[model samples]
Target: MKLVQKWTVFMLGLLVVSFGIVLTIRAELGVAPWDVFHIGLSNQFSFTVGRAGQVTGFVIILLSFVVGKIKPTLGTIANILLIGFMIDLLMLVVSSPTNLIIRYFYLILGTVIFGFGAGLYISAHCGTGPRDSLMMALDKNLSYDISIIRGGIEVGALSIGYILGGPVGIGTILIALGIGPIVGLSLNKVNQLKNKLQPKIDCYN
Candidate 1:
């Protein structure tokens, strides 16, 4: 059933996001590169992560509409809501870091959870999120190894976060090193499950 499939995707997406948040909470030092940049930009302009994320999502969605012919979809709206809501909620549960170590752990857990959600939520292929759009664009433009390009983009984002007052601590480091593989593994697993459980679905690309 379409409803059942969407439900499964929603639940899995929640788990993935929760896991990433855990990492973010644990990586006490700071955020990974991209988040750091986004958070940093938010701070420089006196905005919350949720607001920034939504704004960014809107901008990227518009761009996608122009370039890739991506029409508005429920999943796209969900992406904006999901990130914005969680970032706001986290401001309550994840406190300002007292030390570098605390931030390190928070970020690590958050990254894992985030990656997990990316794999699960993205399987729906309803639409790509803001951050993902940037990556896909870079992947096409650079015409080189995707992982390397991604790493470069992350570093740039982290630098921006540093300037914006985001935590550029141990958490950032852990994410730079670990989060990619976790996402890849999760995507692979999700794909396998999809193939076995429902072969007719054409969600994943």
Candidate 2:
């Protein structure tokens, strides 16, 4: 695929991801570890969650580059700049539901959508966001198991976020347990779709 096309996909996927994130937030049940951190920062600083996320992403990018020697790619830069803004924008319109069933629906739907969005962006072959970059760096530098590294990072984030007054509940546990399998499934589907489309794309090219 062309560079522009790849960027288009990346941006679109980020938009979808942001929408999904907003849905989860609106559900008011809880959020992912990184999101908990973002929300905590927002609450502490009196800023939007998106702004908090942007600042966090910027810091992580710097740490990844300086400490881990991981260069930020175009996609990485875009991911930092775009997703947070989109999330804040979405939040302006997406209000939390008062009904219990509806809130759970939002949480579940958001999780699936988030997973699909992740798959789409990953399949674009641009680059990963700051958090993933950090994970890779830690895995490489620490010589630890990747799962252990990831779990450590997330648990640390979760702890800090909770201390900072972020919400924690069943939704957090649900996301933690369910997101991996959902993302795996979404990636498989995205790959299959990409494979099927490749021949058509080649013909057009």
Candidate 3:
């Protein structure tokens, strides 16, 4: 029963995060750096963005497993598959707002929701998603501060995606700088709530 609840929460988080991703893309201000790379691949290779994302995910997973020695968990597998599906499905259904102000609203809303979703799954403590696992693995193996490694990854992705003609805008910069703090805040809040809800142990005489 506990396992079921955890899985449910994880899947729900994935769905919410994927929706937020689609919303960000629809806003057209910019996209997450990794997503920019996916979009660039789609534009260059004539594949759908979702397909490109799946391919990229597989490669990253492979690298993380083979080179980084990170093992996969069910949550990791689900993340790779479900997030792509949700993003594609959401894209089909959700259209971009025409008004610039409305679009910025979407961007902000998407970023917040994305952070919340991350907090949900992470608080579950089942497992790390592929990208996240990879990030941690890289940090561990390379002996660099996680922040520095993350920054390097984002910069590399952004540069390659830009070179490949992915859309770049203010939102891209905003997400790069802001998402860490946002997600960290969400995680702290969620963890605190979880601790509060947990049954306290009583010591017997």
Name the candidate that leads on lDDT. 2
Tell me the tens digit of each residue's lDDT in model 2 across 1-205: 5667777877888998898889888999999898999988888997899999999998988888777899899889899889989999999999999999999999999988888888878778788899988898787689789999989999998999898988888789988998889888977987787778777662111
Best by TM-score: 2
Residue by residue across 1-205, what tens digits does model 3's lDDT show? 6677777777888888888888889999999998889889989997777878888888888888776788888778788888888888889999999999999999998888887888777777767777777787797689788988877887898899989988889989877777778889988987776677566521110
Q: How does each model score on TM-score?
A: 0.74, 0.95, 0.90
Residue 197, candidate 2: alpha-carbon lDDT: 79
lDDT of each: 0.69, 0.86, 0.82
Better of 1 and 2 by TM-score: 2
lDDT of 1: 0.69
Model 1 CA deviation exceeding 4 Å by range: 7-15, 22-27, 63-74, 94-105, 136-152, 199-205
How do the candidates rank by lDDT, highest first? 2, 3, 1
Candidate 1 per-residue C-alpha lDDT over 88-126 given as tens digits, one digit per residue, 9 for 90 to 100: 776667565677665555565577778888778767666
Instruction: Show the lowest summed lDDT stretch of 10 residues, model 3.
Output: 196-205
Question: What are the per-model C-alpha RMSD values against the true structure?
Answer: 3.9, 1.9, 3.7
